[model samples]
Target: MVSHDPAPADPLSLHGVVPPTVTAFHDDESLDEETTAAHARFVVDRGVHGVFPLGTNGEFPLLSDDERDRVVEAVVDEVGGEVPVIAGVGAPSTHRTIARAEHAASVGADGIVVVTPYYYPLDGRAALDHYRAVADAVSLPLYIYHIPSKTGNELSLSTLSELAAIDAVAGVKDSSKNVPWLAQAIDGHPELTFLAGSDSLVFTGLEIGCSGAVSAVANAFPELVVDCYEAYADGDEERARELQSTMFEVRDAFKAGGAYMSGVKTALRLREFDAGPLRSPLRLKDEEATAELRDRLESIDDLEW
Candidate 1:
């Protein structure tokens, strides 16, 4: 196993609104590189601190290896170094995960977002070892992705601390949504950075020392999300809370739909972005639901694409 310790040079700390990009698909659900690159550039142009492609919000699991590489390359080339692009590089298998990480590095990704190995339950030691192997395999900075609800394996605080000690493990995306644990993680490792994995928790996360969030809601409303962070950063608690409350309606609307990717795609289409639809087995939101989403968004006039 690789040793976890501070690297000789600390990687860039993840801060502000980093939207986990949604993959653009054609009507037949084939990868749409042009639309994908356009969406990526759209977010960057709207002023998010960074763009994270192929994350859970990006439907990472649905994408094949080649598709993943193409999307990452498209985003990298489009952004052209305007902002950091952290490519998702997680797989149920360690070797495959490492290969994805290496690919991200080779393609000039700023960093990698790696989730704990899923499909099998893993204890702390196993989790530690898995991440260590991946970290050892690549030299680029890594942000540990901890979403226990989806993976069925929670990254305990001890595991996070252990990973934080790794030279290449720069930070973590704590999707736990457990506020107490988030606070504990922040207090325990003041030196390590954390990004909230949920939209509802972004403000609270920042209040408790988390750097920022990789928000799903940011995909639909980039400006509002960025405003919340800027408001909190400037210590305008009331304004931040107000903006956050407005986003709650949209966030809840996303949850009401069976699958959020479809809702997001529909919303993008509503905005004339042509994000297409979700792949098989994931149906688009019903017309009624899409109408509700449109109504909810209409109230928030400041929201940008």
Candidate 2:
């Protein structure tokens, strides 16, 4: 097996609330590196344990190679030492994914999250080979990004078992929303760190032994998730559930109009941190819908945003 010295703290030990941050863009739909880095600082300051740039929340599929690279560099430059920066380097092909992974490493990302190759169906052996190739190319810890709904490729437990044997394969960020699958994966490989990738499952994941979460809701309201995590870690399950309830309210408000992604950026704006617009083919809510969202969020008494 290939091995390399772990970066900073062992990334395998990565825990607590980590936000898959938004890719801030200017009004003209240009990459706003300044606000992008600023958003990372925002979450880190709010007590997020780590930051993940260029994931689904980041609109990774919408960016060019250069734009993605710059986002990673900008984030690392802003908060490299404060918390681990796990950059999303997944692409649709193994060769391209390895190239992006290499760039993330070169620019100082502590680790990389490689989603399974999307748009094409593949079996377990091919999936295993793809990850092995990427792991071989990068020394940083590699996290499998499993969101089958978006990617259309679900990882089998047998493949996950084989992946656990690769020294460079550190963990998984599972957005599969399959609680049983996640539970089995955690039971099946105690060596691999498991992060709940959905905001809905943060508390449930902790209860089931996940080390932490990669929360999209955290991009806007990190403190809520952070408090939920701390409460659980501190052995206050009741407190954690209370906070998770508030989080669910916040999540509902954000998803109120089915523009959940837009809702996250909108919530950020309401809190006075303009992450600006999302990239093209994706959009902000229309005026009336946005206003309704604002009213709905403000009604949540426990949250300020």
Whole-model lDDT values for every prediction: 0.82, 0.88
The weakest ten consecutive residues by lDDT in model 1 span: 1-10
Give all TM-scores, in the order shown: 0.94, 0.96
lDDT winner among the candidates?
A: 2
**Quality of model 1 by C-alpha lDDT:** 0.82
Residue 93 in model 1: lDDT: 88
Q: Could you tell me which 10 consecutive residues in candidate 2 have the lowest summed lDDT? A: 1-10
Off by over 4 Å in 2: 1-12
What lDDT score is found at residue 88 in candidate 2?
A: 96
Residue-level lDDT for 283 in candidate 2: 85
lDDT (Cα, tens digit) per residue for candidate 1, span 1-305: 11122323447656889999988889999999888888888778777999999998677888899999999999999995888899999999888899899999998999999988888999999888888999899888888888888899998788788888888888878888999998898778766768889988877887787788888877877888999988887878888888888778777767665676676777777788877888777867888888887887776655654
